[model samples]
Target: MTFARHCVFDGSSVGSEEWCASLDEKDKGDWSANEAADYAKYCVF
Candidate 1:
């Protein structure tokens, strides 16, 4: 949260319809394998 905000990292992918629909609070700070993949496509791609 803090790191991304300071760096201006957009989380649109993770929070988008496809990614966020599959997530819950359990997958917040500590990401599961699937979440990591989604984040990669959304935030890294």
Candidate 2:
């Protein structure tokens, strides 16, 4: 249950919307609400 390879972190930050949306369904399914929030915070806005 690891998706670390699919993610891109800069220090304590994550990647962009294109990267977020690039995740496949299986990888995305493993995400928690907090992960989604982080993605929205860094990637969406």
Candidate 3:
């Protein structure tokens, strides 16, 4: 869940699209496709 913490939750505000978008430019710092999919499934969906 580190990806979520740093890229999704650790923003100045949770769910901040601008913050998340900034971190997303780093490609979540080495997250795998499967992990991203699972986050999407459990957290996003």
* Order of quality (TM-score): 2, 3, 1
lDDT of candidate 1 over 1-45, digit per residue (tens): 986674446444454654464564345778778777766676453
Indicate the worst ten consecutive residues by lDDT in candidate 1: 6-15
Measured by lDDT, the strongest candidate is 1
Cα deviation at 40, candidate 1, in Å, is 0.5
Model 3 score (lDDT): 0.56
Model 3 spans > 4 angstroms off: 1-27
RMSD of every prediction: 10.6, 8.0, 7.7
- Across 1-45, the per-residue lDDT of candidate 2 in tens digits comes to 235544554333355545466543337778888777767676665
Model 1 quality (TM-score): 0.34
Q: After superposition, which runs of candidate 1 have C-alpha atoms over 4 Å from their true positions?
A: 1-29
Where does candidate 2 stray beyond 4 Å?
A: 1-10, 13-26
TM-score of 2: 0.40
With a 3 Å backbone cut-off (N, CA, C), the pairs that clash in candidate 3 are none
lDDT, candidate 3, 4-24, per-residue tens: 777767654433555345446
lDDT of each: 0.59, 0.58, 0.56
